[model samples]
Structures are given as C-alpha cells and as structure tokens.
Target chain A: MRTILFLLQKEFIQIFRNKTMLPIIFIMPLVQMLVLVFAANLEMKNIKMKLVDFDNTATSQEIVSKFKASPFYNIIGYSYSVEEAQNSLIDNSADLVMVIPPNLEQDILNGQSPKVQLLIDAINGMTAGLINSYSSMIMLDVNKDIAIELMKFSANQQLKQISIKQRFWYNSGLNYKHYMVPGIIVILVTIIGMFLTALNIVSEKEFGTIEQINVTPIRKYQFILGKLIPFLLVGLFDFALGLFIGKLLFGVPIRGSLFLLFSFAFLYLVLVLGIGLLLSIISDTQQQVMFLTFFITLVFVLMSGLFTPIETMPLWAQRVNIINPFAYFMKVNRMILLKGSGFFDLIREFLYIGIYGIISIVVAIRLYRKTS
Target chain B: MKALEVSHIYKTYNDITALKDVSFNVAEGELFGLIGPDGAGKTSLIRIIITLLLADSGEIHLLGKDVVKEYKYLRSRIGYMPGRFSLYSDLTVLENLNFFATVFGTSIEANYNLIKNIYSQIEMFKDRKAGDLSGGMKQKLGLSCALIHKPEVLFLDEPTTGVDAVSRKEFWEMLQELKQKGITIIVSTPYMDEAEMCDRVALLQKGEIMSIDTPQNIINEFSEELIEIKTPDLYEVKEKLRLEFGKNSAFMFGQSIHFSTSSKSKSKELLNEFFEENNFNIESVNIIEPNIEDCFIKLMTKDS
Candidate 1:
C-alpha cells in the first residue's frame, strides 16, 4: 500500500511538472463545452427556400405567404419559371422550392385538392429530409385554415373536432448539448486517462528502468498498481471537470442521481486503467504502446454508439459492440443522465464492466510476473 | 550458509545457450566478482540470482532460500544496482530514494546510515530532478536507492562501466566500507583492474567458466613470457611473427604488442638481431609479469 502511494505521488508530480499538460487538463474541457454547445447543434433550422409561381394568382401568393411566415423557411428568391428555379437549385441558393401551377385556385374551389409541386433538394440527405417535412407541415396548416373558413360557411357537425396535443418526454426542448457534451466527456476521459499511463511505463522500460526495478524488492503487483491508480484519479478528476462543464456551460441537466453517475464513471475508469496496465506490461516500447492503444481506442469509440444509436447497427456489429466497454459506458451515461435511470437500470452493464476490471487487473498482474 | 548457490544452471533463449551447466557458490560475507567481456553470460547469471529470470534447469539459492520459490524473501535481503541508470528520472533524488525505501517496507531514516556515506556527496541536489544530474550522481543515487532497505547481499552489475575515473575510485572505496560492515557483495565487471579488488574472481567466456580463483592464482596460471615490442614498422613485425609462428606467437596490446611464448629466450635474440638489421632503435624490451588481461587471453587461447 505504501509503495503504491509513493508511486502514485511520483506519477502525479510528474504529470503536474509538464507545464503544457496543466492547461490541457483544466481548460480544454471548458473550451470544448462552449464551442460544442453552440456549434455542435444537430437541430434543423433557418432553411433557405426558392419559389416558382406559374399560377401568378392570389391563391398562389397566399400559399407562398404560409411558407414564408413560418419560421422554418427564409425566402431567398423567387423564379418566374421552372428553368430559373432549376438554376437556383444548381447554384445551391436554396434548400427547398415551392411550385404553384396556373390552375391551383380552380382545382381547390371545385372540391378537389390542388396537386401543387413541392421540390426538395436531398443533397444533404438528412437535412434535406427535415426541410422537406417542415415545408409540408406549413402546407398542412394552410389546408386547415382553408377548411376552417369553409366550415363556417356550411355547418357540418361531424367536422367539429378537438386538437391532439403532444409533450416531449425527458428533454422537452430536445437540447443537443445535453446529449453530446456528456458523450464527449466520456471519450476524453478514456483517451487521456488510460493510454498516457501505459505509454509512460513502456517508455521507462524502453529507456531501461524496468530492468533496474526488477532487482529491487518492489512486488510486481505493487509496481503495476502504482502506475495505474494515479492515472485512474486523473481520469476521475477529468470526469468531474467534464461534468462541471456540462452543467455550467451547456446547462445539461443531470436528472439522475449524481452519485450513481459518479459510481459508474469510477468503475468504468478502473476498467480502462486496467487495460492500460495490461498494455504497459505487454509492450516493451512507447511507440508500440501508443500504436496499439491508438488502434484499440479507435475501434472502441467507433462502435461505442455515442454519435449513432446502437439500435441502428447491423446484428454482427451489435455483437462486436457488446464486447466494447466504451459502448457499455456510453449507454450508462445516457441512461443515467438523460433518462434518470436508477441502479437497477444499469445493473447488468455495471456488472459486466466490474467483471472486466477484475479480469484486466488479474491478467495484467499475471503478465507482469511472467514478462518481468 | 552460503550467500548464493547454483547447480547445472542452463539457460537458452530460442537457440543460443546463455548458460550451460553453470555452477558456483559464494560463501557468506565474500565479495565475489564475475569478470568477463561483454556477452559472457554474467548478466544472465545475475538476473537469475535476483529472480528477474528463471533458469531452465537449475536450483539457485540466495542466503539459503530458493531463488525462484522464495523470491519475495530473497528480494528483501538483496540490493541490486544494475549496469544502466534506472532511477526515476522525473523524480528528484529524495523522491527516488524514499520511494525505493518505501517499496521494501522501510524508511530512509531507518537505513540512513547505510547510504549516508554515498548520499552525502549528492545531497546538495536533493531537490534537483534525477534526469538532470551528472552520471556520477546518478550512480550514487541508484546505489543509495538500492541500499535504502539495508539488504544483506549487494549485487552490482558493471556499476562503473561509464563512470569517470575519480567516481569509480570513490565507488570502490564505498564498497570497501560496505564490506567492512560484513555485507556480502557480488559485482560483475569487464575491467581487469577491478578483478584484483575482489576476494575472488571468475573469468567467464561464452557462458562457460574459464578460471575461478583469486586474482593472483589466475595470473599464476599464465604459461608464457609476455614481451611488449615496439618496432619502426610494428605492422611488419606482427605480420612477420604471425607468418613465422602462426597464431600463438603474437597478440596486440595497445600501440605496442605482446608476444606470448614459452621459448622467449630463443626468440628474444632473433628479435634483437632483426631490430639491429632493420635499423630500428631498441629503446626497451623486457619480459613482463602477466596481468588479468594476459591471463584471460592465455586461458582463452590455451583452451581453443
């Protein structure tokens, strides 16, 4: 225990000695928080639109007003003909377009819905899809207003209906920063906390310290545990800083128990740090550790389902994601923060992550014995 | 009980045999030396005794405890300063010393007297990071860290290889002080001069022991008269001797050369005549006593 503390203190001092690491440790997360909260938004808004009006009537002008008045579209330009509208689209001047033919008012007055053309550019496929859907929403509102006007003229009791209401669960405002910042925090902790310790140890060995320590009375477990535990603390410190930034800068709500999130984050850091210890034991050089850890972290984060939902992955990829600890941690973070889940909700993930930590410490200790 | 004992210690890495049927023992309080050139298996043998490595077929006992089975107990009684400087570079001298002491379940104050003599020289820079220290200071700190627990056996592997001359002298003087306290020491060195300082020395080559005895006794085994010859054309003389007497007659020593032979009387007169004929000045020529280097070369050549 004393040896572990001594080593831990030494490691921390070394970390703080590198003046460049201080700013990165403290300020980088807050900077990321600020930039990402405002810049990382995935919400679809402020759409640019063009119009092609062939009808040139009052009805066409009223429909165009419906689109412009709605906050979704800012009418950039209007084309007198379809050729001009095509040129507008080719020049990327607008993301959406409205076409009103000459017979639009006559068709609707005759009790037949007007077959107006709605052109949407699907170049940025997902965003284009949202813009298309939003424009159709405006058209629906126009139809409802016309229906209400006509219903006043003719009394139809069957057409008197009440409105259906909706309430967004959990995140009522659909805040993007609330979700993205926490996930980014988890990823930063993984990269900075775990890999640096392993690379440092490997560098010492390459520089010849392991051989020196081998002859000393330092137990294999003590040596490795000393290297790992301090880095684990650093990771937790970073985690706390990230959480603080998430709350202070982005106003990301922590609906779940903070203690629960802290517990899982600590356990998950143990798992990551254990893997770092194992990497240090197996690798003989810093370059090797850095290269191998880079590959492992890349694979872990890609399938972690942080940016994308795990439900959308194919079956085989989902199976691969099950073995990834980052994937489990990502789920734990979202469930705990966004959904206000209790311990029982993360019981299975917590157990597997705990098991992984135990196995890694055991395997790393075994490797130290044989390889030393 | 013996401080160290080994039997049939054979170690092979892939296909190369590092140690073959190697066996030796060091009595308690003896400063035994393993003297040889590079790659003579001295390191492999030290590593086994320190429990960093295991021999394929052998039993090693340190202080009457099995090295492999009782590694933890044996480690507590051993202090090892490896050939390379392996102290924590980012840490200050104090931190490294305290850390190593803590690892052995002891404190620096408890073992301060043991390392005090050596540590005092480098004490001025206790706060300086070890990475910035000079080579001599590093070796001192490494020794201090190793001795912080006051182990019974002190194992130094080529501790003076890259050190300056004065520091080497100071290091040996400190070893003498440790020896006065009845600590058993086993130091390996390739420097032949260091062999005479030990209680007993073994000349090893290619994982095989060539000679094991005191320095005087090993030198007594040299069966040739060594003469250092300097001629106008030294290369011509060496070639002439190699051409005439084949391999056994000539061996290079520094700028001049040593001719090792049992019949130097017959060759001495011929050499003078050749020198007089060649108009080379006979500044100095005399039969010299055999040092460890000469003794080692003779042992190696006699066996081959």
Candidate 2:
C-alpha cells in the first residue's frame, strides 16, 4: 500500500538517523555470528572425563582405552575413591566418571558380567545425556570383546541380531554452523524487526508524539504500515547482510531459491511487524515494550527449535511452533541454505506465514487504530 | 453546520467515569475550548472527537461524518495535538512534517502554505532532531505537523501545559490566526487565563460539564460577594473568617484569604471584625471579580 511505503520510508530514516539504535542493530548481528559460530557445537571434541578404576584389570584398562580413543570423550584425570570422584564432579573438574569395582576381572572369568557404574552430571541435561549414550555404546563394544573370547573357548553362546537403519537425510554431517547459522538468522531477523519496531513506536507514545499522529487525517492502516515498513526493510537488509556473512565466513550454502527466501521472509516480516505494532499499541511506555519484547522473542526463539530438533521437542511446544513464524522460517532457512530446498519444498510454510501475516495485520490495525 | 458534535457521551475506564452524559458542539469555523483542570476528561473527550478513542455511549459527528462508524473519514478531517509533545524524537522537524504530510496522500509542498506561519520559525533547524528542540520549538513543530494535512477540524489537547509563559502567549496568538483561516479549533487547557482566549469555553469537573458559555458570561454568573482579605497573620485570620463569615467557601488564593458570604450586606463589617477577633493586622481588603479558576473551585466544591 502507499501508506505502507511511507511508513517503510520513515522507519528506514529512523533506523539510519537514530544514533543509539543503529549500531545495536547493524553491528550486533555480525558480532553474534562470529561469537556463536565458534561457541556452538555438538561434537564435544574435548570432554574431560575422570577414571576411578578400583579393579586395575586388563579389561578395565581396555574400557578406559576405548573411551579415550573416541573423539567425543577424553580421560583427563584418575580418582581412587568415590569421594574423590564426587569431588571432581562437583567441582566440574570432570564431566563423567567411570567407577570399576574390585575383582571385576575374576567376575568376568566366572561367567558373571561385572557391574560398572557411570556417574554423569546431568545438570546440563543435553551434554550429560549425549555423554551417557556414548558411554553406553562403548561398554557394548567391551562386552562384545569379553563375549567373543568366551564364545571361542566354550562354543556355546550365539551372536545377537541388531538392526538400525540410521540415515541422516538433509545434513548428514550435522555441521554445527550448517544447522546453527540458518536458525540464528531467523531469530536475528525476528529480534531486529519485532523489538526494534516496538521500541521505536513506544518511545514516540512515551514522548506524546503518538497523539500528534493520532489526530492526523492519516488512516489507521497507514499508521500501522508506517510503523511496520521501516523495520521490515531493516529486517530484510539485516537478513541479506547476515546471509552474506554466513556465506563468506562460515561457508554456508544457500541451496534454497533466493526468490523463496525473500518471499517467505517478506511474509514473516509482515507477521512480525503486525505483532510489533500490536505490542506498541498495548504498551504504555517504552520500558514495558522492551521487557515484553524480550520475553516474547525468548519464547519464540526457544520454541523455534533453534537448539534442539523440532522432532525432539514436546508435542505441546511442537504444536505451538505452528503459530510461531520463526519456527517455519528456521526450517525454511535450513532447507534453503543447507538443504537447497526449492519453492515447492517450502510452499506450505509460505502459505501459513502469509495467512499469519494477514490475520495479525488485520487484528493489529483494528485494535491499534482506535488509539489514534 | 456543526463542525463537531457529541451527544450524551459516557466514557468510563472501569470505576472511573471519565465522561458522563457529556454533550457539546462546536459550530463551523469556531474556536471552542474545553477548560478544566487535570483529570477533567479533557483528553479523553478530545481523543474521542479525533477518532483516536471511542465513547462508551455517545454519538459523535465530525464534519457531518459519524466518528465511530465513519472513523476513517473522521480521521482525515481532524487534526489533533495531544497534551504531551508526541513527535518522532529521532526525526528532524522537517522529517516529521514531511512524514505526516505524506501519510495524508499529500506532500509537504502541497500544504506548506497552510503551515508557513508556524513552520518558518523552526524551518531553519529542519535538520536538527526534534528531541533536541526547545519546548517552544517542539510546540511549534507539533502544530506544524498537525496543520500540514490542513484538516477541517483541529483538536489541541493541552498543547501548552509545560511551555514557558512567552511560548504559551505566542501559541495562543497562532491559534487566533488559525481560527481566522476557518479551521474549527477545539482547544483544552488547565490554565484559567487561556479560558478567555477561546470564543467560548465549557468548564468541566469530574467528567461532567459544569458550565458552558463565553468566558465573560460564566464569570458574570458569579452571584456571590467575593473579597480578598489579607492580614499579617493570614492563617489565623482565615480560621476566624471561616468561623464567622466563611459559611460560603472561604479559601486561600495566594497570600490573601478569598471567602464568600451569603450577601454583600453581611460582609461590610465582618471582614474587619474577623481580623480583629483573630488579633491580626489588615494590610489589604478589596472586592474582586471571580476568574475561571475560582469558578472551577466553586464547581468542584458543588460536585463534592
């Protein structure tokens, strides 16, 4: 709309002219990209593990050797007693502990499986869970070694049958930045568009200029569009910059169609811009806007499955993601850049985001126009 | 034709009745004023007329268009400047004007003449951010933005509450000039002196219209005998006056005691006797005409 264009132009001017907000928006994304790309990873190449080997047998030593050989875990220190192991865990000197009881070699020769305890600090549920799974798998290999030797001597046992079709579809390697950069871009656009616009509008109302605009012959749609356009443009500009940096720095690929990325991004911007306007209308001051903005964005980003797979989230959060525009775009961004998904691949998301955009704009305009 | 009209408007924010059965109208090309102190529903009523807010129960017509129904139409016809300076602080004076003008499907050049008188003052600092402007300059900039669209109605809600005295004076002068240009102006202010500036004023108290007429007519309705009596010990003298001659509202207006009496005949000997009884020296005593502030006090007393 013409009103939308005017609003967009005004928003761009404010973002450019406002000295306090320009750097916060323009520079912070790049800075965060640099920090996060290095900081975020699931590979866990250097986890410090402690060994409390009470048995000191060949088998126990072999188990420790196998753990140390894997790229995921590293044996950092040794402890003799449970107290020392617990102390190491509490002090975060070790992430995991392998405790072997005495006479473990005798028990394995007596045809009894020696019980080994793996104490893991589950406080950081993600890393702890991953470490536990890896530790369990390594134990299976040790048990197989014991079984193979026993089987050759006795000739009584049979090998078990296990089948797993582990096919990693889109990102087989699971490069952290491949998964991380796209989702981060989604959240980045969301933060810039929603919070910044909310701040800009509430600041006007706080200063009493909202009343001046309210009295104008300008339509409510114009006012709402005016509030939206600048942030949307800034959001898009930031989007391109983030995309460029992702390509140049991290070597992220944009496999998705550029048209599809821009199209859905435009739709998502509309949805978020409506939300920003709604927030501005509901808030009495800029402080409230900022607080609520932070809260909403936190919820949106977390629920978007930026950290965990959407398949891993609880059904409730997964359902809520349907309403979250970022959830869809996080997928779209990944599909487009990492997976090189086409327009047809993201058609459903594009439709939903468009619908969300239209509904939100309508509701925000209807509710906000009254305050004019 | 009526430029603006409201009939039996009742607006309540929960338990607080901001406007109750309030009705008033402004004729075409008239400068009407809603004069009241803070919390008198001045802003609320102005917001409704501007179509930025809606009345809980009322019929409002702006330029013969229904405010609630034809809101979009109403908005295009009215210009509002709220009590507080609400402009884009980051934008310069010119940017604010141009942005607003663009919204109305018009360019600043198209409406520049309408705001030429007020805009010229701040035009030199068009590049300076609005946040850095002086209060007077901000006020002028707000006026320019509101007038840039050249709406049929201009609703100014306490536009001069915090500006300096000279700025306030200049603002009223500008209003007078705008009135001559056939813009129906509805100005609200808490300042009693400003009440006289409007062609007519409606004194509101507790969300109700107490009185409405020309400023002189409202003052002329003051039937009580008002006198300002000062004594060396004014507090002591006021107590004595309240005891003897304060059956009518006796209150302090600055250093003097302004108290009314049932009749002028009862006041002749009482002021001197009250001061003597209170053991005070009389520096001055004279009969004075009631101003809008006094009328408002009287109205608030009656409402209470």
Q: Cα RMSD to native, each candidate?
A: 3.3, 3.7
Separate DockQ for every predicted complex: 0.52, 0.54
Query: What would the per-residue lDDT of candidate 1 be over residues A279-354, giving only the tens digit for each residue?
Result: 8878888888888899999988888886677888899999998779888888888788888999998899999999
Model 2 steric clash total: 8
> What ranges in model 2 sit over 4 Å off?
A1-3, A52-64, A71-73, A76-87, A99-117, A136-174, A314-317, B107-114, B223-226, B247-251, B273-278, B287-304
**C-alpha local distance difference test of each model:** 0.83, 0.83
Worst 10 residues of 1 chain B by lDDT: B278-287
Clashes in model 2: which pairs?
Answer: A7-A226, A8-A229, A208-B86, A209-B86, A209-B87, A255-A340, A256-A336, A372-B52
**Model 1 residue pairs with clashes:** none
State in Å the error of residue A107, model 1: 6.7
Error of 1 at A61 (Å): 4.4
Q: For all the models shown, what interface RMSD does each have?
A: 2.0, 2.2
lDDT at residue B169 of model 2 (Cα atoms)? 93
Error of 2 at B150 (Å): 3.1
